[model samples]
Target: MTLPTPPRLTLTPEELRALTTLYTTDGAWTVEEGRRHCDRLDVLLAAGVLMPVQTLLGMMYQLSPQGRLQVFGTKDLAHSLRRQQDRAYLRLCLQHYGWTRTTPHTTRHLTNYLGGRQLIEVMTDGGPALVGGQMTSGGYRGLAIKEIGERLRSPALHDRFQVILFTPRPSMGQTAAAPFANFLTLIPLVPAGEPDIHYGVPTRAQYVPPPPPWDTDFEWDTPHITASMAVRLRRDDSPLPRSSVAILCEPRSARIARFKADLTMDLAIADTQLRRHYGLSAEDIEGVPFVDAVLRPMHANTSLEVQTAVYLRSATLAYRNDAALMHLVGVGEMRRHLNVVYPSQWTVSTAGRHRIEEPDALWHRGAFDVAVEYDTGEYKLHHVLRKLDGFASRGLRGPVWGVPSARRAAFLQGEVGSRLMEPPLVTQWWLPETPFMV
Candidate 1:
């Protein structure tokens, strides 16, 4: 008789130690280093646990997020540890709402807990969301719905259950979950003393088409790479020594479009004067705005801008460190630079369709990578910090806020800084009294 196959082997302590080494260290591992650095490298490499990342140094291996979780046996050590407080608050909310843990099965689709015979699927997010991928309402909705159906298959658990989708902050306008509120519950998972959470579908129309493109004067022989393409090239050209966050404020959509168009015109005019001084060619001058895609009309929002600013600042910091020179990356240039970095963070379904989160600008110099948020005195301190926390999760340090008034800037720095490990930097930008007419 054929003997039953033995259970797959568990990872040896030696293998786990090797994985911990790769997980704790940053940068790619060379083939020679991989073989010699740790005894289990060959085992992990054969197990498809190490992923290849192409760097300036060459091909190197690093433990993928999944690989790390596999060897570590728990997610507590992952970068997700950054949001532990938020997750704890989410648990508090569930406890407050009377949800209880009744079952303890370790299945892949393990139900979080049970409440009076109803199975609950809980999706928790502590970062900016609603645009897609992992943290959005849509992503959680799909998972919860699928799990609900699976649980209903058990005759003991019926359709009396509800899925709780918890986010530390609300969506951009409190409208992202309107379309599906009937099917699920969406709630902000903040602690007491913060703003009272509101739960109404926004009235604004859902699908806003982008404004028309601007007309241009010059047509060069070579077509410019799209802004998205340019940003990706910069990211690949130099990976940051460490991940970072940059902050910046964004005005309304109309103002955002006008600023980009004006920057393109101003840059072209200034380049004409400085071309000879800098000994640059026509191709070089033309390529500047082309790379930025400032001439292209696109929508921008504050949320996405925050993500972009972090990336642009990080890229600038990396470049400055390597070249010993600074580059002039302005408002419009920063917007274009975000195209590559922010899209990946977006949910897969919304990635191509959504506009870049708009920001006024970003700055990166050595250890001073900062997101320059332009505060219009509109955001609540807690709401603003929630957005910043999203950036911090990606490896940013501190926000350098640009407030319209000194009094408000001081208030923000004091109130917001007390909560953070390092105080936020504040600066005052004297915004124009009225919108600048074209």
Candidate 2:
């Protein structure tokens, strides 16, 4: 079944006058003034001259300048203001006042109304167009609408608008072959532009990356524990999804002195847990006088400072990988690598194992291994750190490493003059031959 169309909301003449007055006034109104305005509105509503109180209030809220409408009513009514349906209704009312309405599915009507030079110019004129909460900054909207206007100005571009509307099946995952049951003409105004482009409407769908391998190592489990603790300590409340974690481990002989100082003081686990697991009490974990004396310094002194540098090196590599992934996927994947790698006796061997290699390699061999056998997580972490160190130590003077980009290749070839050629023109409109619409 199709979704129900929202009702059209309008205000009576008296209610409109009140709204106008409110807009014109400054500072909080006295109780008497508020009561008088409410009484006038109530009288009109009683006589069927004004819309329902809720509808009227919703419209008023939308019309008010940002942060100004919250002072209008009782606490009970204020609570309902947060609802999305209320916000949508308010938007509908504003749209009715500002622009004439057509059937929701009428792409032709919308295009005819919005496509005209006069209307496009006006919309792009940096005027207030009621978008939900606060009025959008005209400059921002103008830039967007201007791009649209530029596209529509060209007949070649005008033909490119491909509007499609469909009730996407909830069960079907994103694929190359899913057919949309309904379609509408979409006008490509801005077209696709860098850094990224978003067209059509937004939806609330979770992006699930391809499934993990059957024998995926659980090394990710440790990073998750550490990351959760870090997030808790920082009091970060962001709702962004978590993807992968990078762990940087620095293994040193346990006899090294000043090793604890190199680690983050706020351990992921409490001293009690550390003591319970390692046979060292809280005092011993904290390096109390007696306990500190018992743990002998190594013949070769290794400072916490040295350990931290190694960990930072590893973390930086992890960051590079993250940046690369984000470049490929519009969304940034979670970087779960540990900021500090701790010394541990744990070891794993993969003398003859096979597994998928690089992230990109997955698409090619379906699976491939860089080496015959290695501790996948530890090896990757160490390799990335070592590569970063090499780049830094060599002053990046010679051949650059990692997945080389066109930009990098140009930079390295001493073709600086040729690389500074004029920027390519961005086509804002679509040609008639193209399959997709804006």
Candidate 3:
């Protein structure tokens, strides 16, 4: 039997405050936190707002996904550990080999660079790409510059292959004054990891009948030679197939602080074959969070923007080879890449300021114009209502409002949904690669 869900939630002001507080928090709350809301917990749970888990530290409460959507306008947790750039990039790799290729059967260690750490090689079509892993991300403050040099200085990497190191980044715009990130790449003269190059006389085959130009292959570069040594010795000939390299460093951001709330997630691999072959768990596929140390974080009005970009790239690439999805997004005369479109793209530019009004995303190509606005439920409700009102007043099919949760949808419907001649579509903010052609 289904419990009847009320069309409108009738909550005390304290309950609303608790919901807002939990929604914005990066970590979970202890049962001690339950004290203040003790009386109201049952009500919120019945309404699908508060989800209390009996943690090792006693009972803790986290906002339910639906409640988060209702509050934030989307279910995507702001503190999701999966959103790290390096990890996300690796996810892109798993979606397709072009992004990266990992070989668990032949795991290798990097001398000087990866130190004692052993990670599966990250490969590319052109050649060897990068070997990425976590570096010390000692919170946001300790993670600035000092942490990287000690890690980045392998002094032993190839010229063509980069020594890729990843760490959790400080918040956006935090490192403008920080120096250019030090890094290197090397494509070996021989097949990657096959170090045939040696300190040799000019008579050797490597320099035998030198080309019109000297065989650049045997330049005897310091980085390359050292890289060869690592490649020569990097292998873990041990028969055990443990997919471990201390997978991911915990980011100190308060947002994802409680990732360890689930201990079983540790020691997991994202590759299915690796797990089955290695006799590991099918329970989880958590990837390592690793990206170039040089990269920086940006404002997250769009942490989803980064995710969006990756999703679009992956989806479009699939359409190219997969017959069933060839015209999945219908990128006809319009640009295939994502670029911000302006009032000029719309035929009805005569609307003045409304044309200047910003859209979170737009699907415009001749009559297929649908401008979208994403509300995380972060803005003042009135401001959102006013923005939507002005947008709808323009009288196009959209200016679709991409909301996060059900309550937000209800609120929009209760308020703006009825106010406009054609209020924009209020749906979950999980955008498709393309603005879904509604």
Query: Which parts of model 3 are misplaced by more than 4 Å?
Result: 1-175, 178-356, 365-369, 389-397, 404-406, 418-438
Which run of 10 residues does model 2 get worst, by summed lDDT?
290-299
Q: Residue by residue across 29-138, what tens digits does model 3's lDDT show?
A: 44545556547676666666665532112234566655565666785535532223223323322333344554655323333354444233565454443444321121
lDDT of 2 by residue, 289-356 (tens): 11000000111111100000011111111111111212211100101111223223111121112223
Clashes of each: 14, 10, 15
Worst 10 residues of 1 by lDDT: 302-311
Model 2 misplaced stretches (Cα beyond 4 Å): 1-99, 103-143, 154-333, 336-438
- What lDDT does model 1 reach? 0.34
Candidate 1's residue-wise lDDT over 1-438, tens digit each? 222423333577776776676555323345555676667765665555665532212234566544655776643334321122223334345554555343334222334333232333432342111111111121233344345334433422333333445544445323544544444356654322122222532110111123334423343333123345335534665211111111111122332233334333222112211221121223332222211101101111111110011111112121111001101222222223333223223111111121223223334435544454444455686767775775566464444454434566567667886544334323211111111110
lDDT of all the models against the reference?
Answer: 0.34, 0.23, 0.34
What is residue 43's positional error in candidate 2, in angstroms? 29
- Cα displacement (angstroms), candidate 3, residue 51, comes to 16
How many pairs of residues in model 3 come into backbone collision? 15
* Per-residue error (Å), model 3, residue 134: 15
Candidate 3 positional error at 269, Å: 21
Q: Model 1 has how many clashing residue pairs?
A: 14
